[model samples]
Target chain A: MNKTGKKIFINGNEAIAEAAIIAGCRFYAGYPITPQNQIPEYMSWRMPEAGGVFIQAESELAAINMVFGASLTGTRAMTSSSSPGISLKQEGISYMAGCELPGVIVNMQRGGPGLGNIQGSQADYFQATKGGGHGDYRMPVLAPSTIPEAIEHVMTAFDLADMYRTPVMLLSDGILGQMMEAVEFPVYKSKKKLPEKDWILDGAKNRKPRSVFSLMMQNPTILEKHNYKLAEKYKKMETEVIHETYLAEDAEILVCAYGIMGRICRGAIDMARKEGVKAGLFRPVTVWPFASEVVSKLGKKAKKVLVVELNLGQMVEDIRLAVEDNKKISFFGKPGGAVATKEEIFAKIKELIK
Target chain B: MKAVYTKPISLTETANSYCPGCGHGLVHRLVAEVIDELGVRERTIGIAPVGCAVFAYDYFNFDVTEAPHGRPPAVATAIKRCLPDRIVFTYQGDGDLASIGTNEIIHAANRGENITVIFINNAVYGMTGGQMAPTTLEGMKTTTTTKGRDVKVAGHPLRVSELLSSIEGAVYIERVTVIDPANVIKAKKAIKKAFQNQIDKKGFSFVEVLSPCPINWGLKPLDALKFIKEKMMEYFKLGVIKDSTNSKESK
Candidate 1:
């Protein structure tokens, strides 16, 4: 709980804004988009009070670039948007990651292949985990099943981003962004000292000016070297993988889910156990790197593994790779902005038994 | 005798990579001299555009970052807002600012962000091998406009300074060229005025410099200067289009 007595009943978007404030994020720029609009709405008023800067940018394109600019000045900056808006931001996001600038990007996902309704979906999993933009790079994608977890992820995102010198994503969906819950935000502090950003463009007061650019296309060798450096960073991120397991030590069936779907799976797993079925939940907290080691270990023992999601089986592919011939994988999804209820999922698990 | 011509301390020894007779070198020098004169090099943060000046940061002796094509103005807005005490400016080309990044430039100017835009309108995308730009003239031919720019096929060349000057948030807007020595001095003066406006917190200030690209235009160095004076200047008028602060002070 926040010792400052700052606990409040709020939605995920509002909680994200309050968490950003506590994490020392001093700049925000974003465009208006559904499900995520509350973030910009909340930040618009709260940021100025906290002596920070906020801009309702003309478009998501400009908003990401503005955050990129603020990040280069060695300040904590962030931007939030839905699926379509995140697509428009890919170019700037790619540029930021290429330049190795630290920033936080919140993608409160809405259903999409193209303008797919304003309902929650996990279709953007591959987009976030695998390079969302044109790049040979990756960023830590943190998915939270609850509002408190979302707040916690936002705080951790900044520290990891600054530590890794890459952008970090707080991946959520409309289901979480729109739901109000009683939440207590813990004051966040970096446990370790980060290297001073001598590369930031804060003007050359006592030293020569620093320049950060992404256009290394002129020389093939330069871009190759840059890619090689990014690979090294990605390797370092493997040590920080995190996941959660609920009664997977001895189970016949295991459920793999992320984001809000993971929370839904908890009850479904309990329902399965009540019906004399030994089922468990393996939820990924860091979607990238994906805690594959745990999934691999658990997959070897399980009789059946069901990957549940709100999208059309995107993360199922990762689970398949993690389990790779050790066990056969099955998928259950309610795509097109539809969510599966606990009883509905439990029935699906019953069908898998026979 | 004191040296009358010395390299600006704000300009680096990095040999400019611009083709011979390109105006970017001259414009970059003028911006550096202005920064030197204003004594803001130490506190100046520059946003580089994606055109030929993509490496504009390499040539300057101050802190600089590259923004995706046409997003420098937005970048400058955030940088300037985050550190109000520092001086921020964006250097962009015609294609980057006028075409792809039109909305960003307009909204930033409309918000009256206290920053400067050094818009280089060379009438073509020089870095991308002389493609027809938004500012490419009606009859000008390029790789994309192979048959010359047909107004019906494409559109009228954009007059960026004239367009931006109409916005209330734009405090100072001027269109100047750096073709000749006399006009080069005028261009420098316009740049200084734009930066000075920021120092005075006079909201958005813009300088649209009609620079020349000889290699791209397939013209000789001197003839390129003539092209700007004769053809480009006709559609794009020069001189100050807006001086909101200057007008207010006079009243």
Candidate 2:
């Protein structure tokens, strides 16, 4: 193992790929998609050196299914894609979720409801947080605002996936995925003792045969029982929900955002503070199983809330649901690849404070 | 009294959900028997496709995972890659292989993934009630291709074995039928050879079985067998489509 703790200059995609390799991801299958192409390109040669398997899958559909097969064998498998590509991957993701298999999916968000531009956008907030695929299921969606957080989230995503025996999504956008930064990739060590994968399909050998499948068509009651079992697992996963607060201890105007928007809001918050406005930021690190309670508490303390995103008010709805009281809540969005500047967010914060 | 024949140890006591004269049951038994004969039952993994054989995991008393419709090849590719020592194979029907899963099957064959594929070609979507498959015979009457499958519109039946045989990565490819006792025996031999090729690490091996879906074809079980022997075999010729393994042995 290369035990170097030295910081390396890297982009978000390479950082995530290297971090995944270091986090013990041994199987990667993905197709080339813009904004996240560097991930598959980096894994191509790096995976072979790390004694892992990497295949440039034929399509996004095939890539996710390949990850499914590898994960069934209890190997740390992952696939990465951009917006439209991720839409193609939903079927396999649903299967992995239904089968209760452990795998990591990284979606470097690009603008889309269709084949949208390759530029960075957060329009996929609804797709990522809500059930993007068919079925009543949820994946722990981790949103990292910076390169370092991207690395940490990749590792955490793997750990969470294995712990819960469920697929996890590390949601990043094109801005963070393409931005260059100096990040010191940490050596990952699991804090909790992850459960042994007693149900993996590594051949029958000395035990009764095991099957990993979700086709419960024989009985509706059986399928309902399985859904309840998954519900219980999701309830247990609530304890793992994470968020970050920046200068929100005594702020009256709360700026709520996530992913790159969160980082942008932080800069805006600092500027707002310098201008004598008590503006703060609330960022949910994990979008699904969201930071509802914390946001609600913060909303009660703050006189008003300003939700900012690079999309047309996706996460703002979640904030509204969390902060259920009729506080003066406002939203500022830049939909479809329109990059939001820190000055723009600061301006929005100024309006909210007024 | 010595036992002349018995069920393969790899098969479970769970009764199959196949139709009265479906070829899946017979083919499943052949595969299980081959796994037993090769002594790889304990170290074998099967990928079941979405079709009538969706419950194959229950029938095969070994580690099995169900892949989405027409994606067993992709799934088996990863399983074999992850655990190369374990024998991995996929069982697919016409709709699952020749139609919806065409890309996956083609790519897997092209990559020469060290896996076995049991391609059962009944020429119709048996599970979904006799829709026109990619391999549906020209002029054959399917629910989707009512009156008859128009050659101009529906196109010709896909000879997947012949198509895959042309790929350099595919080391072995054979097309056989299970319409009669003699043909059944030949089909088993082909299936066994496919598994043996994987055991020897001879790249990709495929066996396409001309199966009988009696209910879907709207025929009696006996007539279904006769149909495969008489009409299906005329278009999908039986026998080895490609065998680079034999040439390698000669060399």
Candidate 3:
């Protein structure tokens, strides 16, 4: 409780860690990687101080799996990594989704097809939003455009994970991770102590023995039952999808974006508005379990939808699906290390309007 | 009136899910007896591996968490750190411990995490139908090693306990086989000592128990035990490779 209404100047990584602690995260396992190394460093020291567990796993694969183990015990757990390391964690993330374990994964994205760079890039948009691992499962992904949003999303990520009993991702980039910002800490609550062994594998002494497993035995009907249960959980998540629209009521061209690009798109929309052009912005806060209805309702009024992103057009696919080909849509993006600047986005909007 | 020998104290009354003569049941019982004897049952947390023993959570009488393949050590590391006063251990099969989970186990040992690792080395993958495993012996037949593990291609079997003993962080490392009554006694002693080391906060302690997988080995129950003694032991030698107690006494 510092001055400025519980406000503190902190970096993005520290904010993420602080948010996790406030959310009652008792376990953190991660490997060191640039841009997001502060996350593991903060947890390594803070978790121990808070009577939580912190482990610097040997690799990203082990780190994510460690989170899987702790989460299975009905504990709030998380791991953070960059692009290449996040790629290693995909298998475990996929398994967590399959098993319906509640956990959070933070991707402080860097450039990559492979070991691309330690610098910031949104190249992982497709990997974060779409199911990166080998499965038909969807991880609810939150893209944070600002440091405050990064902290807010970290808190929301835990609620969403527990709400749906699934893994959630906080998709950020190096700039946001390393940047410092003024943030107010959330009120901390000591987690209500639940029976540790209620559903966990603490030897079968006090209650009926339990198991946390993802393998559906070779029985097809049982597998189908588990899949059906998962489908029902996903259906409940649809009601929680969220987004924001700015000046879209009379716009003829809609600019759809998310994460950092969404922030830049808002700037572009402002520039277009000054020129007396009817341009509006749709910023999706939740990338997966997407805000499709909002996009469709806005699509009805706009003549053309221009999707802008820092990746090679990943969110554009979701926009297309939401609009359902009913509106003319085109995508303008910069892949690899290039970012979509406000001027570049404004040019794209002008082109689309013509 | 005489008391009958029944399921051990740390184990629940649940019937085992293991195949007949599988070594997991024996090892689980042995671990349970040790926990009960040590009076740490209430404070112990067990980590189950991904294999036939994955459901160990159902039979073991303690709080347990099932880990993904080869991740028990990492999970155990967290639990022990969070609850330092609690006794935490991970029970894993050969494939889950020695293969994909190699890095997790080695790093945990090297970091000297205060936990016990009960490794069941049954030579073959029992759950997924007798696949070739990292511990599968040379000249032995498995579904994946139909031609008898070709050393040139697959490499020789790994001796995990001996390998782990070399790490300075490991406080205790022992390998014991449970094929016969005598060997079962030795295996129990080894497991008990491993747990005792953790109770003493000695650092990482590992007990690799040589188990039998009758279903995967294509042999009868007795024959599987015989195979473990006659064939598997030749590749995986049994003995204590490290004891930090001796080092502590010397100091």
* lDDT ranking of the models: 2, 1, 3
- Clashing residue pairs in candidate 1, if any? none
In order of listing, the candidates' clash counts read: 0, 0, 13
Model 3 scores a C-alpha lDDT of 0.84
- What is candidate 1's lDDT per residue for A1-354, written digit by digit as tens? 344556689999999998999999999999999989999999999999999998999999999999998998888999999999999988888998899989999999999889999999898998999989997889899999999999888988998889899999988999999999988778787755778877888789999888998888778999999899899999998777879999888978989999999999999999999989999999999998689889988987898999999988889998998889534688999888988899988988899898
lDDT of 3 by residue, B115-218 (tens): 99999999889988999999989888999889898889999999998889889899899889888889988988999988888887888989998898998898
Which DockQ values do the candidates obtain, in the order shown?
Answer: 0.88, 0.89, 0.50
Please, what are the lDDT tens digits per residue for candidate 2 over residues A28-70?
9999989999999999999989999999999999999999999
Scored against the native two-chain complex, candidate 2 gets a DockQ of 0.89
lDDT of 3 at B12: 87
| Candidate 2 CAPRI level | high
Evaluated on chain B only, what are the TM-scores of all the candidate structures, in order? 0.98, 0.97, 0.96
For all predicted structures, in order, the TM-scores are 0.98, 0.98, 0.92
Model 3 over residues A1-354: C-alpha lDDT tens digits? 222267789999899998898778889999999989999999999998887888888999989988887776567899999999999999889888887788999999988788888777888878887789987788888888888788777878887887777899999888788889888876654322223323544344555545566777758898788888888878877776778888988879999988878888999999999999899989988888798988988876789999887767778888888888744988887776667789998998888877
Per-model fnat list:
0.88, 0.86, 0.53
lDDT of each: 0.91, 0.92, 0.84
Candidate No. with top DockQ: 2
Model 1 spans with C-alpha error above 4 angstroms: A1-6, B247-251
